[model samples]
Target: MKILAPVSSLSEALPLIESGARELYCGLSPAAWGKEHGDNIWLNRRGPGKANLADLEELEDIVTLAHRKETRVFLTMNQPGYVKAFYPDLVSFVRDTLSIGVDALIMADPGLIKRVKEKEPAAVIHVSSLAAVLNSSSIAFFRSLGAQRIIFPRYLDLRVLRKMIEASEGDLEFEAFVLNDGCVFEEGFCHVSHAFGGAFCHNPAWSYKLREISSGGNKVSQVPAGGESFQQNVDEYKRWLWLGIKNFGGFPGPGGYPLGMCGLCALPELQALGIVSLKIVGREASLRKKAAGVKLVRKTLDLLEAGCSESELRERAGELKGVPGLCRSGYMCYYR
Candidate 1:
């Protein structure tokens, strides 16, 4: 499986390319979209700032640089929905990217996919994980619709993944996350609003408010219905659950991005299953860490390719990355 790393700017392009990221993907926000929508509202998932490319030139430079290395680039326009008024501009965006020689567009919306496909009929399309494609027929349906790839959902189990791969019958490419951030909500199906940016779910304020209500159980231990608390729970978990997620390990450390989450141990299995691209998840990751993440993924892929045994792969993952005992269990692994 090739490494499909994320890039948000021209500065990140070369270092990642050199680190063995053969296919780089990112979200792009053009000047026109930002001007009308305002800078705060992103065209897709990542909320502005450094998470997406600022304009056409940076995108062009990234596309140009990656192409010079013979590395393919895919752009994300994977918003769940766009208003009727957005289509003409969306088509313009697709055409502009096609002009830049973008290899593919990764998006969840079929309507937007149709818009792009109409403009550049030969342009490769990748079904984003946000599409929540859970079945063989669904993938087949996408394949029939001109989608060349599927970014497999983050929480899918190994058995289901194997079944999906079996169903595909070598007709499509699959991209699975191997390292870093994953969604707390099941990625594809969650039509999450980007309230106070896309990091809304990561907001500690939600948990803190519930904590004041003295809520600390898998169920609602505290009732604030008539009070000032705004408590929302999920998977039958209480408010501390987010804190548990943040400081997830039985071991102590910061819970989120800086701490490594890995599926390197499953790489051998994934490759055997014909997954074409194993993704390193963060698009907004720091430049140095992006390079490191790619290098680390490169090492894992190399070790797997060099006939490393599964046990050894796990150990080597710990040695190179994938901090042992933190998210080492199946719940944290992408394929498991």
Candidate 2:
């Protein structure tokens, strides 16, 4: 399987490629974007900040360098949806990037995809995970729109993933998350703005309460919530959320690797299932973290190629992360 690493700048291109990334994806927001739409509106889902490259020249440089190493570069325009007024400029921006030798456009908005295809029919498009493509019908819909690949969302069950891949019948390429980052809610359904500060789900100040429901189920009563068993379930859910948030503070686990959701152990099955690319998320993360992620996935893929058993691969992956306990607990598993 091809290792697809996230690139945030020209500087990160060579290091990531040298570390075994055969494919690179990044976001771009040109200077004119802020001037035209201001800071409130984001050019992509990541919002206007370090998550995206600030200029096109830098992207061009990164693309040029990546192509030299036989590595493909994909640009993200994967905001779930965008305002109608941004279409004219958005189309132009996409065309410019394609002209700069970007291998494909990673996009989520159907209207944007249609517009891009209309302007540049031969342009390669990878349907973004934010599109929430969970079923075969969604796959067919995107394929009809000239999408060459689909990046599966993080929450899909393994059975569903297998069915979807089989349903494709080798007509389209597939990419799945392999490391870093996780969302509490389905990303496509989340419309909250991050410009205010952080995402609504990631806010640490928020609190949760369990209320007793009336027998008729028409009202919530001001009671002590539930018995010990029910409260234990609630506590466990909270613990899951905390771990999902990387200990609720973005702290790294052992070896300074940013600890979040991971799918290293699923590599063998994904490769056998015809997955074309294994994506390493977190374009906005530190350079160290990004490099470490690529290296970890690279080592895992190498082990797979060496004919390691699934059980051995799982143990090695946990050892590589230095958190076998977390792996055993299923807290960091992407498939689980």
Taking the tens digit of each residue's C-alpha lDDT, what string does model 1 give over 163-185?
Answer: 98787855688988787665667
How many clashes in each structure?
Answer: 0, 0
Candidate 2 lDDT, 143-234, residue by residue in tens: 98999999999978888999998887447999999998777788888887766656665543445676667777677665445656655666
- Stretches of candidate 1 off by over 4 Å are 39-41, 195-198, 202-258, 327-331
Candidate 2, poorest ten consecutive residues by summed lDDT? 197-206
Model 2 ranges with Cα > 4 A deviation: 203-207, 215-228
Top model number, lDDT:
2
Residue 84, candidate 1: how far off, in angstroms? 2.9
Query: TM-score of every model?
Result: 0.82, 0.93
Question: Which predicted model would earn the best TM-score?
Answer: 2
